[model samples]
Target chain A: MIVIHADMQIKPEKREAFLQTVQPLVAGSQAEEGCLRYTLTQDVANLNRFTMIEVWADQDAVDRHNASSHFTGFFKVSTDFFALPLKAEKFTAADV
Target chain B: MIVIHADMQIKPEKREAFLQTVQPLVAGSQAEEGCLRYTLTQDVANLNRFTMIEVWADQDAVDRHNASSHFTGFFKVSTDFFALPLKAEKFTAADV
Candidate 1:
C-alpha cells in the first residue's frame, strides 16, 4: 500500500471558501478505483492549515488519480485560496 | 512499521480549545522513540472534523506512547471537547 500526507496552508479569511471548493474533489477522489481511503483535514491549532491523508493500493492508482479531471479541477482552484505551497510526503509500510 | 489514521470530531466553537489541549501531547508524542511522523488535520469541508496521521516504527512504540503521561493528559481533556468517539485504523504496507 502507498500512503500520502499532504500539508496545505489556506488564507485565513478564505478558509471556509477553500474548503467548499475542495469538498467535491475530495468526494471524487474517494470514489476512484484503488482509493482505499481519502480524507481532508485541518490543523487543530492553526485553523488555516489543512492536510489530506490518503491510502491507495499502489503508486499506479495515485498516478491515475492525479491525472483525472477531478484533480485538475481541484488544482485549478487551489491557487486562489492557498496561503503557501502544498507539501507532501509518501510512505510505504516498513513491515508487511 | 505501523501507520495509524485517527478520525475525530470536535464542537465547532471548542475546536481551538481542543487543539490547544492536544498540541503539547502531539509534540511529546513526536519526541518519543520509534515515532516517525505525527500530524493533526481537519477536514476541508468540515471545520469541526479532525484527523491524525501517525507513523511508528512498530506497535511497541505506539503502546509505550499510549502509556505515557502525555497521552493520558490528552485523553482526559479530549472527553470534554470531543463530539464523537475517536475512530482509528491500522495499516501495513502491501509491498514492504
Candidate 2:
C-alpha cells in the first residue's frame, strides 16, 4: 500500500473555513475506488495542525486521486488557509 | 479511535539493525488486543526515515501498549540507532 502523511498548518482564523473546505475532499476521496483509507485528523496538542493520512492501493490509484476534481478544487482555495506550505511524506510498509 | 504517527530517523549505518529490532515490536504489538492497526513504514525518499502508524481503540489501549515489554525493549536499544530524537504526534479524527 502507498501511505501518505500530508501535514497542513492552518492559520488560526482559517480553522473553521479550512475544516469546511476539507470536508468534501475527505468525503470524495474516501469514495474513490482505490482509496483504502483517507482521513483528516487534528493534532491533539496543536489545534491548528492537521494531517491527512491517506492509504492508496498503488501509484496508479494515487495518480487518479491527484487528478480528481475534489483534489484540484481543494488546492484552488487552499492557498489562503495555510500558515505554511503543505508538507507530505510517502511511505511503504517495511518488511524486516 | 486514537492515531499516532511516530517518526524515527535512523542512523544510516544502523538501518539493518534498526529494522531487525523493530520487527519483533511490530509483531508483538499487532498481537495485542485493541490494536486496530500497527504498521512500520520506510520513507520512500529518505531511506533512513521510518514512521510507525498506529491506531488504537482508545487511550487505555495506548497506555497498555506503552507499558508493554516489547515496546520498552525496543527503546532500550533504540537510542543507539537513531540519528535524531524520536518525534511523535497524537491525533483524532476531525468531525467537521
Candidate 3:
C-alpha cells in the first residue's frame, strides 16, 4: 500500500476557508477506486495545522488520484490557503 | 476513533536497531483488542524517518495500548534511537 502524509499549515485567517475547500476533495478522493482511506485531521495542539492521511492500493491509484479533477482543481488554488509550503511524505508500508 | 501519527527521526546508525525494537511492539499492538491499524512506514525521501500510523477504537483503547508493556518498554528505549525528538500528533477523525 502507498501512504501519503500531507502536512499542511494554513493561514490563521483561512482556517475555515481551508476546511471548506478540502471537504469536497476529501469526499471525492475517498470515493475513488483503490482509496482505502482518505481523512483530514486537525492537529490537537495546533488548529492551523492539518494532515491528510491517505492510503492507496498502489502507485497507479495515487497517480490517478493526482490527475483527478477534484485534485487538480484543489491544486490550482492551493497556494492561497497555505501559511507555509505543504510537506507531503509518501511512504511504502514497511514489512516487519 | 483515535488516530495517532508518531513521527520519528532516527539516528542513522540506529536504524536497524530501531526497526528490530519496534517489530515486537508493532506485533503486540496489532494483537491488542482495540488496535484497528498499527503500521510503521518509512518516508520515501528519507531513510531515517519513519512514522507509525495507529488507529484505535476509542480513547479507552488508546489508554490501554499506552499502558501495555510493549509500549512502555519501547518508550523507555526510544530516546536512544532518535536523532531528534519524536513528534506525536493525536487527532479525532474529522467529520466531513
Candidate 4:
C-alpha cells in the first residue's frame, strides 16, 4: 500500500473558501478506483494548515488520482489561495 | 474522530535500529481499543523521515495511548535516535 500526504497552508482569509472548493474533490477522490482512503483534515493548532492523507493500492492508483478530472480541474483552482505551495510526501510500508 | 501526525527525522546512521525499536510499539498501538489506525510510514524520498499517522476514536483514546506502558516504554526509547525533536500535529475532521 502507498500513502500520500499533501500539506497546504492556505491564506487565512481564504481558508474557508479553499475548504469549500476541495470538498467535492475529496468526495470524488474517495470514490475513485484503487482509493483506499482520501481524507482532508485541518490542523488543530493551525487551522490554516490542512492535509489530505490518501491511501492507494500503488503508484498507478496515485497517478490516476492526480490525472483524474476532479483533481486536475476542481482542486487546482484552490491553488491560488495557498500561503505556500503544496507539499506532498509519499510513503509505503517498510519491509519490516 | 481525531488524527495525529507525529513526524520525526531520525539520524540516518540509526535508521534500521530505530525502525526495529518501534516495531513493537506500532503493533501494540494498533491493538489499543480506541485506535482506528496507527501506521508508521517512511518517506519514499527521505527514508530518514517518518510519520505516524494515527486515527483515534477521540481525544480520550489518544490520552490513553500516550499513557499506555508500551508506548511510554518502547516508543520513548526510539526518540533518542531522532535528529530533530518529534513534531506532532493533531487534526480532526472539519465541518466542511
Best by TM-score: 1
DockQ of each: 0.47, 0.04, 0.04, 0.04
lDDT values for all models: 0.82, 0.80, 0.79, 0.75
Model 2 clash pairs are none
DockQ score for model 1: 0.47
TM-score ranking, best first: 1, 3, 2, 4
Cα lDDT of model 1 overall?
0.82
Candidate 3 has an fnat equal to: 0.00
Name the best candidate (by DockQ). 1
- Candidate 4 structure quality by residue, lDDT tens digits, A1-96: 565667788999997788788877888898999997676766433567776777677778888988998899876587689999898756652111
Instruction: Count clashes in each candidate, considering only residues at least 3 apart in sequence or on different chains.
Output: 6, 0, 0, 0
| Top lDDT hit | 1
TM-score of 1: 0.78
RMSD of each: 3.3, 15.0, 14.4, 15.0
Residues B1-96 of candidate 3 have per-residue lDDT tens digits of 666778889999999999899888998999999887676766533668777778777788999998999999998987899999998766654212
Off by over 4 Å in 2: A94-96, B1-96
Q: Worst lDDT window (10 residues) for model 3 chain B?
A: B87-96
lDDT (10s digit) by residue, model 2, range A1-96 = 566778889999999999898888998999998898686766533668777778777778999999999999999999999999998866553211
- B18, model 3: CA deviation in Å? 0.3
Better of 1 and 3 by DockQ: 1
TM-score of chain A taken by itself, candidate 3? 0.95
Error of 4 at A9 (Å): 0.3
Interface Cα RMSD of candidate 2: 15.2
Q: Which stretches of candidate 1 lie over 4 Å from their true place?
A: A13-17, A94-96, B10-20, B76-84, B93-96
Q: What's model 3's lDDT at A89?
A: 59
